[model samples]
Target: MNSELKTDRVFLEIFKNRVQAIVEEMANVVLRTGFTAFVKETGDFGTYLLSPQGETFGCPLDTGYNLSLGIPAGDVISSIGQWNEGDIVICNDPYSTGGMATHLPDVYLLKPFFYEGQIIAFGLCFIHSSDVGGKVPGSVSPSSYDIYQEGLRLAPVKLYEAGVLNEAILRIFLDNCRIPDQNWGDLRALMAALNRGERRLQELVERYGISRVESGIEDVLVYAETRVRQMIEDIPDGEYEFWDYIEKGPGGYPVRLRCKMVVRGDGIFLDFKGTDPQVRASFNIPTLNKQGHYYLVPALIRYFRTLDPSIPWNSGMVRMITNDAPSGTLLNPEAPAAIGARAATFIRLMDVLTGTLSQAQENKLPAAGAGQAAIVMLAMTDPVTGGRKVGVVQPICGGSGARPMKDGIDGMDFAVGHLRNIPAETVEADMPILIERYGLLPDSAGAGTYRGGCGIDLQLKVLSPDTVLTARNMERMEFQPWGRLGGKAGAYGTAVKNLGQPSEERTGRIDELLLQPGDTVSFFSQGGGGYGSPYKRSPQAVARDVRNGLVSKDAAYEQYGVVFHESKVDLDATQKRRSAVYGSTDEQQSFHFGSAREQFESIWSDEMQLAIGAALTVYPLALRDYLKRCAMKEIDDRFHRGEQVQAIEVAEIMAAIHRTIAAL
Candidate 1:
């Protein structure tokens, strides 16, 4: 309760924006100095200022990954021994720093800003490393079952001690990584950004005075907390429950994510009690069970910003909200769990959060969109130097869900959308690869009054031998994005090997694929779900989509009942078709999850899944993944034989697996 900040309203607003501008300027410094394509070209980096206590108070508006707006910095701050005048602490271990890094590739650094022999604030910055020491070239693979296999796990330590270089630690890190020189360049870029932020912060303290600057930092937290509470109070106090998944269910469990959001007055409680157990894949999110973790409540944060439009980026926004994502779940796994592909799970968690909150608000949020992204990278050996080289081909971006009044963003989802698309020429220059096709997927979006966004279609050919193609965060292939309010479901993701060739084959999600010279491959991202009924859409709008090559005439006729004759809609025939298909439509349903998911949900009812999910958890962590797959195989056999399963019979199936497998 600083009286200076409490009374001076205009000064507080200026202080907030000034802090943001400093960080924004810090972003430019990193882009100018960063070496890797991920840093300079893709812009997979961020710079911000934190309170002395390590709460993020300022973040850039439109740079880097906005998905990490409320990222926690306190754990990294507390882990280090002490803060000196010119020391920079860095770490990438998710387990040691209380899930501050989440994955190894994302290296985070924190620097304390001091003035007059006292700590004023902290400078925080992070950049995604092209590669750290790991099994794969990119240091990311779905097959990685533990953190050790992912990359070099660094605990919080003094990367820059008293403004002097720590060559001993630097040499060890460089020796472990793939491209030592480029990685070191990126590290220097981060240090430069931190130093730039520190300079601006010193100027801020000089202009505003030490007492006022300190008061402003403390006041922003109180302001953000009060504003968030006011917004949460608007919703009626009730418990709303919703669930979603990552498609790879163990037996029937898949990686199901369930949330029970309880809104009571100004405080919101998120209980993730029914989420599926951690899997063997690199999909776990090590959140350390922190209250209102950034992973658990990203959607809610987006909602708050939408409502207020100027909410402060700090820890106080989460002060009124509490979370209970139980230990052992993917959201809060134990130590050493693989988290290379945790971004995929983080995207799905947003879906579950949006679904839960949509129940409380009437048409507040749009239906789910292509809620995933895959980073396509090509790895090869440089012929001249025989050195390892990896280049990001492109980001497989997806469309957003259709909104109530507007269509979703086509071919670029807001989730991790800040990662820019690399140019075709740049891809060619960096690696021996040829771009065959790169554009939006036609007829991929859901059919609704307001159509969902379209996904990407990228195909490339390798020009060199012994090339490895890796794509991470591939999802939504098994379970397509579901639509709400009588809207139809969107298209599912597709991956193919040698598409349209004599050796054509449909590949699902690719962990890793080695390519030969002249071999071509294709990757298609999923489109977003639509909002409202397709039949109610304007025929002209459907015709526009057809003309733009985003929708075919046949789909326009069948899905939207829009009769297009010679590229022109025949309104009379369209009206008749709509009237004829009225009775059998999805008008009565609140959510249209498409035929595939609908049938899957019908076959594996919630009762059966809950029973099976619980049964699988009883086994040891190492044994559950294997047992679940075996149990699912047995269940699949029963399905093929036309046998129906009840919840009561689940125990018998579990007992059989336990006896046959556990006994051995």
Candidate 2:
């Protein structure tokens, strides 16, 4: 056959299916043979096939952990320098891998697929291991100040060389981790999956000539790029800017993220110029300035997929997009900036990108969601061995935002959709904990024509002493989820210990807490923001929601102005109430941020944020972190002390910051 025929559309699609099947089989092998609760029960693992140059060619699509499908392996490939048959390499250092592995707990393994004494492709897989040896038992904490405290940082190194297992490296890993046996078993499962992928890939190369297989990879990527560029061209060309903030960081300070997107013809540019400098906490996201990373591509990909699912999932999807996240900022933090809780920042970044695109595309996007992952980890002493055991009790997620024509999904967030929560039965059997109650929170969703989804409420009791609970990405406690197009904002999240008793303590965000037996911990995730005006909603729909216990009678009347008597909608009364509650249609506000955020933004306006970013740009990178803290502290102190500052006073603070940068 001619070269043209080998790279034809039909042949390229056939090869793509073959490669995808190989990765799916690899994932199945890991799922069945893995030894940890993360892999076996939660399915927190991913498998992919890569080209020799380290671009992802194929990955499973129907699985929950599809989040890792677009991760690039080029850094690991380049670090190895050379590849041989039957050799395998491993690494989990986010900095060394250009943020490919994300955090140190995610252990990655790669093996080269050889054909006729030459490397044709590579097989790759990663799993969130049980432990990697760090200051915390789970090896991840939001309070961590640097990477050193996160976990064991593994540079690119050969775990197996020429079919021989590197025993020395294995010993080093086993000696450091808290659960040595669990880690060893999980690593072996990864190796087995890679071997299965290698066998399947070699078979494909033997069936179709090696040259045709190689050409098909190139054709698939080119096709994806063409499809995505066309999608970008469909969007109106203009510059759109959106900004969001994290409520609190490690030092009890809020951080802002600014995104300015420019769409011209068939390409887009994302510049995070006014985002806050990187904090000393683990909330930083290590994007490494790469556009292909999911931190930059997922939001766009999600939008495109909603338009057309036929678009191929590959690395080339990011080819039409470019990013400029200033170094030392939260998006592209410098080395040693703790990234253990990077997921918190990543979820909010997705929201900011969605918000910007919503402005540019107006009716084409949905309103903002909860915008946080809300992961909960529990560590307790093993009753049999008296050894510490750490495991994820619940990877809890909030609701998705309401769509233009439909309501948001209840009790689910897009970011953590790939990770399944551990079943209550498994949690009770494996750990010394009792799940008291778990279900959706009522009357939590924002009220609108198309109401947003509700968040979750979980209550658990500790059955063992010395249990430590660490929950990351607990946000929206101070600022509720913002609404769009005259919709009302959603409720915020909260964490409380001993709910009804006098010892009830509200811990908005838990880093680490010690509990005794019989202590109850309750957590409530934030709901999604609403879309459109609440008065536009049908009274019948409100009555149904009230009957189903999702909406209370008081909220239905107060928020939506829909009167319900004995679970029945009073049509005449509803109309009169809505007209009186909301004065006039023209006077209705388009967006509602609730009272907390509105109050905060009045003091810290968008212009002030930009001025602070510009002034910090002139300071040395080493001093930027300190200067940012000082500036925010001044504002935070006055805001908390119930003192109001005029706009002129805020501008003077900005001028003071500029003078400090110049003096240095």
Candidate 3:
């Protein structure tokens, strides 16, 4: 290599490593001094270093999910005035923060990194605080009607001036939050962490010069962009469409999510044009640009890692893809749209994207994983102490979908991985809830030759009255995570409790369910779909899984066509059954859940939900949620008004059309 070129490459690598190490130290600084358990123990925080031009250059990989928050950080910087060196801008407004802090609980701060009287880079950090004062104690709920109901929304304001902490702003924060002491502690920790990040960054500039740091940022992004483009180039370019549904919304109607991608060479355009419009509840996505970042980054990261993990996360990875989601769709909602549970929609978006990419390049992508194992907190006030106690008693998740050559990993965290379930002992000690049961649900995994992962089962009994539970980004209650090949579908999810009688199958939202000492609640999460035909599965493997309680013997017989006799495998009978059911391996039987798919199919189609959701997006929350549930009244009221019929009527029409066509 040429001497000049070699020098530049060496300098770039050194600069990149230095900046990354600085961000790593920044997170450590926050956790060490933070007051809240969420930040100190759970480590629910992130640190990033941004370029001068409002671009995310680097971030700590281990902390936070990915670089999606980078967009919000840049937004914070640009929205604020000409920021000074010591001015630290803080905001948690989903709208004002440019979707950086997705919800209120997450506190985001942006500080300009300066060198010799000029702004060079920005240091950013965000932590999910334990409480922010809302309708619920934790400031999150699936049924939240408005952002105000969620919690305090902070605009971009300097929490610090001339390196002096702004006590007034600090006091205002502590005054509103339920846990004032912990909130103050976490705020100080965030400021301290940013200072550490800034200090380390300055040291790097001193060592390698600012010019080298700038060049390294460009080089790292260029390298990542090239690898991602090459990966996209290998696939046969064409337009592909994939659509999925969410079973648990305001009215429990399936919300249709459609994505049509046009891929030509190294470029791709993702259009959610025909997708359903926004809903009234917390499922709506708040920021357009942020939503785009959230969808593209994770998918590219997953795909690129399959090729090489050495690729740095920068704009280059997502440079090849463009998003075209309209303002009113579920993916991009208007103002006042409740977005606390939007992560659930993102999970389906990732799944739909993966499914689409798989069709284009089968070998490049992994099968669908447990979509989103979201954390649902049930918090209440202690009657005696008058203090708040929160418990993440059940963080529900499904099994990962089966892979090409291997079974899916059980209880996987697909979108973000930093979420760790709080220990039962910690909850009992800190709160009044009793964790009765927390374990994997057997026979819940999708059945195939390579089985999907199994989801978790949780049972909690509330010991205090007036407890509030906020369940966000939770789905798979109706449409289960799908499988590839001939894999059987996994079990659907459920959330119920003991009401008047001991057990009654009840469904729907109970935001403020009054509970006595004996009242018990149970939540069963969904599982991932399997891959390949079950008949082709090895009899020995099935037996082992059955023995381990991962797979039941009945599931083996029903899904895999494998039978065991008195604890031992009936090899002869199993072979005979496999041959009779599956016949020659060459002839692939397309097993149809005529009843299963039809069950959801009868309610709505992708096209209908898109049309209705589009129309409903312009309306207020109550109207949108009403359209989702009591659309029958809407259909009957407007059948002849020349306006388009609702989804319920459309489903009925489609069914009638099918009957007519079948008769012909």
Candidate 4:
């Protein structure tokens, strides 16, 4: 181990805050000068200061999104061959940079900071562009089959060489994308943010001397690692495994995700060995087989924060943890696999991690929330100019799961850094749509002593003819978010059009829809899972929820065993009703996955998933996706066709799969 630096605790704390302030300043610059609605309104951007080794040393906690916190740029930097003082490297390729940029729409820029003719640090910035020239207007579609169909994929290339702009590369972006001016403006803002961070880093070096500044950074990282390791050691050493499924895949098929966590001493290992193979749709996460920890780091930081609020936020926090996912699985897809909609799978993975840990430490973890971001994008023709106007209507999200000590937050999804919803006025001004209704869904939260958060209900009326719509990350439609310790499961959400009319249409998670003028579209997000038993809730709390329009009177009485008479809770009657309903004490289970998941898992059990995964391992890597798809199709066909399938039938199917594998 390296010798401990002479820096004191006071100096280290001060320097940590100073570095965070610099990154915050960098984010402010980008937000103030950015061009697209996604960047300014939705805040889809990130800023960070990276060490010479490309590990993130500092990131803004108050201003930018946390999705890019674990993006590693070491490979991207090294792939560029060499760098100069004014050079800026740009990349969006997931495979080349070890999954630094998960999708093509997120454009990343990196710049090196130099002091005394030696590179001291790097400034990194990324933003989700509105358009990058793809098969769809928004540059992302759930139906896209490959990366080539998603958008232009840029490998690590020099956007600026020795302070000289590369006009050729700039022209290529302008000529190919639908919104050239907006792309150019966002790119310039990213460059400005990088420059701002680089200048601030140099100033820090000048004030504290290069040696002291570098040592301070190293000390901060070591401090973070030590704190996290100590926290890991506290948890009882054992192996905890969990399995969950995605309700819909590329062709409306179900995809399964399994996780096994082994905590031994100060080290933790996360293995995704029995996860389903990569899908044909855009839901695959290109984690580059186990090298990328982008999907695992965010939840770990959140977990560690509960233990030690002062733990430094940097790449070093993950040093004591290791991640492993088999190649060609949903977490680590091969080349050309569409990944534009990978966030759908990524958030579910977060739940898998949370669920696995909750098994060991139920008191420390909350239940599952609305596990995905329901982003609605609309493309319509301008009435006056007859030109296409494409923009995000709203990134609708749902509530958080209930905590041990408190209720979950209503109408907010905390998994994705608490992204704010776009105001209704902003949507009307940008697109030809009117926001009719936007509020919470009544009785949507899971029922428990401390209730889970409620989901949202949004209604939009189209004012333009032939308006096209694309919605991504729509999940929890079939299997409701699971609850813990006897808490009831939350309600699922849906998408429908032309409500209360003869031509009214209802659809499952859709890729695109053409709507005529005056047609209405509605989106209802899923609620979070509750934490504890519902019978233990106070009658006053249930009455308050009913009065506030968050819970229905009937549901409150039925689910919570609360008695209400004419808008008032009868304390004597409530106690008698609770006793009659629950009979002494409420029966509790480790997990309550609701009836939908229970029915689905009855046929597709954990043993069946493992057997299929093991059979595929015998085939060539290139053929695994195909074999897995065929096997899943057979299973889904029996259920979808309304055929009664028993355990014996499923066993026979597994036997047939093994036979096929042996023949191959």
Candidate 5:
């Protein structure tokens, strides 16, 4: 592969930059011309340059919509069958393109680049539309159990032929979605990005020959694969295991995601053998059982880039990695399975993969960050048009986990921080809303030698009546972000209505709620986890936190072993508190999962979950939900009766399920 290219290292480096510039220009065009808040403000979209073989060769330099490197172009590119000059195809259904379009909201379009009547490359781009015709106004709802309930599903079909617009397809789409004009504006922006990529790529072909351009694409992929494999070698070769859970499954049970990572020589294998089967909820990830699907390899992507930033940012980075997630699992769900809320599961997958890497790296990695990112939206009556208007409020995310050498970032974690936030002024101007509070939550940081970043707080008051609100990806409320190496766990998140008023009520993990005029709502993000022991943290650091309003003086004395006198640390009092409070703490403790997960795991351990999942597998997918709930109810009753229920087997559980269903 190396010798066939004939392109030297020096020339390849320059060639890589030139190709990357084309993609960056494409992205810039989309940002400037987009209509929806998701594209214009949140930047929930991307552009990529793909070879005829469907490998991503060029992508944006930064991590904004960093999905360009991981998303496959082959399925979508080939789904249209044949491509002609001045032709474009589009698809929004995940099942049609084989996971190419993750969800219906993420619409994909591709334009093939032709040289002398032969295809040489392709340009692809996508936008997360605000509405795509679903049961709800925004096209996404937590209650959706099937794909049909989510939104309109577009199969691989041509939206343009011979440079002429196919108005029929466009009309069908616009008629279904609530926001037709805005969706049309975003679609035009994507077209602009694709055309720009095609033109810039043409200039590259003219500068270098066509053969060199084709060879350059293949060579760069090889280059990235080699570099990624070398980084994988840094981790000691071994089988490392890790697992985490999603808050709600098909029947609202906590679904577990387990992985066994085997690193050998220059390759890494991710074995998701113990993962739970697909449920009837929106948490399923449509991976299509593809090897090293982009959704499955984010931890590897982050780790490689963190160690060596120069690795080529393309699909080649995942060339040497392999995935073994069984079909029907949460990571590889079948068709008609709801996936509107997969973004929440996407964050969890990254956290779970990072957990496996932490074990392989000997706990050198940073502790867990807030693994959840909430997309808050509001729907109100439009004053001018007298129709329903929906707009995004904010993409609220928490802080980064504390690193071994440095403190975590505040009020924004790295998981989805690349996506921008909506400004308060923008929200107020777009809808009848008032921003009450938009800042970090105090005392939300995890305590350790290096403190984790604090969580985010957003409070808004509705000025109009009949206002409805929806918050997606709200998690870490029950299970806190875990601390590492004897550190204290981060604070949990919460949502409340009419805060500070007589009507104050806690709304934990809400799907949708109605708001009256002048009613206020507050939402929070889970704080990041810390690294190392809190007793080892410097008193000066604790005092600084108190002064900054991030950590209160009382919390400093209680959580951290720090004492203060008149806004200053008292060394003698601090020493006494350290010995009296944290002296019994186990410094060797590798993780602090807070009381929620610890207490829950005591009864519903890994063995218990595996038994339940395995027993339910034999039954049909449709009946598994009812059977699982029944089996769990028996365990629940037995455990509550102080029966120490470890003696149950799959056969016994099945028998109990039958009895429960028969009685019903």
Candidate 6:
């Protein structure tokens, strides 16, 4: 492979860039024709052109999440039957199509790029539409219990037949959605993006010859594969396990997720067999097959490349990987399971992977970061305009975890990259809400030798009578972003209504409460965890943070063992505090995390969750909710009766009880 790369360095570089250009053109088409403000303004869609063999060669360089296109597009092409000219297949079946479409509202369209009646490649596009028919205004919510409730599931249906749009299918979709025009327009834009990819591929074939272009695709994969292997080989191989939590799902129970990976030589296997079984709520991952693993591979690869930058990002990097998730786990759900907002699970997956890799090579990885991205889509029915208004109040994100030598980036992009926050001015112009404030939260950042970057705070006042806040991927409330080594944990996130006026803070629920005039909503995002001991942090850094208004002078003196005098940090006083608080290296005592939450977490391990999930599966979500409450009461009674916590050895039963307690 290296010899091949050496011989074709010039050719590979040119071919790679050319394929990238094709994807860029595809994205441009989508942006030009897209109707919704989310897609046009924020550019939340993706396009890719793959080889007939199901390898992503070229993808959109800007806009949308490109990594999303790689694995799902490959899975879709492989699932279909013999292809022909003008065959466009549509699929939003999260289970059948893998993590391609995490939920129903994300529509995925794929068309075979054919030449001379021979299918040579495929063009694919996906968009998060304004709506799909569901119990809620939008198709997603943490609490939704079934896919049917989430929205319509199109299982590889033909959106276009013999080069013509399927009007009947279009009508069905339009009738089911609240915003028909926006949905139709987004669908058309996706189609246009697909056509652009097809045209670009055809042009490449015309210029470079069909066979050469095909070879180019294969060559890109081969080249990428070799580079990835070399990169893996550079790292010392070993088995590593890491666990992270999604504070709570719609069911109000914290979801415990674990990842046990074996990195051997140039290959890796992610074993999720011990993971918690599928939940009754929409938090379940709908992908039935191993394809859901694709969602995690890009993130793992990205993390790996951060250590070794020479690795190429084409399909080859992860070709040697295998995912062994149990059938009923959240990572691989069974039939009839609801999976409306599976992105939350995916975020957990990324976090676990990051943690595992970090454990394997501490110096090569960053500390645990603000893993979950806060995605809130605010929609309102304006009585004055008589039209639906939608806006993104904030694309909330937390600070990145700190590194060995450097502090983590604040409000960074996690999982899929390049997702930009919508400007406050745009939200006001397009929607009925007025954005009161949008800025970084002072002192919300994780404090350590290298402090984690801070997350953002957003305050919005409702202007209309009815405003629906459809929030997804908001986590780290119960379990703050964890730190590594000797670092401190970051602050938890919260959402409150009627701020400072009989307000209630909500951690894991979405509601459509009527908004009276002067009602305000305040949102605070989670902070990323620090990397090392706060006392070890440079005094100058703390002084800078104080001077910049990021850390309060009092906080610097107390939490961070730094001192300030007359609005300025006193270097000698800070040094004295640091030495007194932390002591000398030899005399310093190791920080101990006691049993404050240990016993609580013991009952919520992966093994126990499966038993609880099994019982819940036998009943519908509503009945399960009642049973869960009873189980928690029983546990509380037992606890009060002087029962030893260790005696509760029934993992599943214990987990079930813990789930209920956490929910309550």
Which model scores highest in TM-score?
5
Q: Rank the candidates by TM-score, best first.
A: 5, 1, 4, 2, 6, 3
lDDT of 3 by residue, 186-244 (tens): 87788888888888878777877877766776676666667788877877889888877
**Which model is ahead, 4 or 5, in terms of TM-score?**
5
TM-score of decoy 4: 0.95
Per-residue alpha-carbon lDDT of candidate 5 for residues 1-664, written as tens digits (9 for 90 to 100): 4664568888789888888888888988999999988889988888888888788888786524875566766777766767889998988998888887878999888899988888889898889998898887678887788999988889988899979999999999999998899999999999999888888888888888899988788888888888888788888999988888788655556777899999999999999988887777788889887777878887778788888888778888988888898878888888788999888888888878888888888566888888887888888996667877887888889988888888888988767867888889988888888999999999888988999999998899997788888888888888888888888888988999999999999998868889988899998787889889899999998898899999998889888979888878999999998988776997668778899888878888888887887777777777766787677777877789988777357558777677677699
RMSD of each: 2.0, 2.8, 5.6, 2.6, 1.7, 4.1
User: Candidate 4 — worst ten consecutive residues by lDDT sum?
Assistant: 645-654
TM-scores of all models?
A: 0.96, 0.94, 0.88, 0.95, 0.97, 0.90
**lDDT by residue for model 6 over 70-164, one digit each (tens)?**
46456677777666677788877776675667778788888998888888887878887757878776677777777888777777778777887
Quickly count the clashes in candidate 6: 0
The C-alpha stretches of model 6 lying farther than 4 A from their native spots are 2-7, 69-75, 78-82, 308-311, 502-508, 584-599, 602-637, 651-664
In the range 236-335, model 2's lDDT, one tens digit per residue, is: 9999999888878645667898899999998989999998888888888888887767676678887876788876677767777888988899989998
lDDT of 1: 0.83
Mark the 10 consecutive residues where model 3 has the least summed lDDT.
Answer: 585-594
| Candidate 6 TM-score over all chains jointly | 0.90
Best prediction by lDDT: 5
Compare candidates 2 and 4 on TM-score and give the better one.
4
lDDT of all predictions: 0.83, 0.82, 0.70, 0.83, 0.84, 0.70
Pairs with backbone N, CA or C atoms under 3 Å apart (clashes), candidate 5: none
Clashes of 4: 0
Report the lDDT tens digits of candidate 4 across residue range 481-505.
8787877778888888988888888
Q: Alpha-carbon error at 505 in model 5, in Å?
A: 1.1
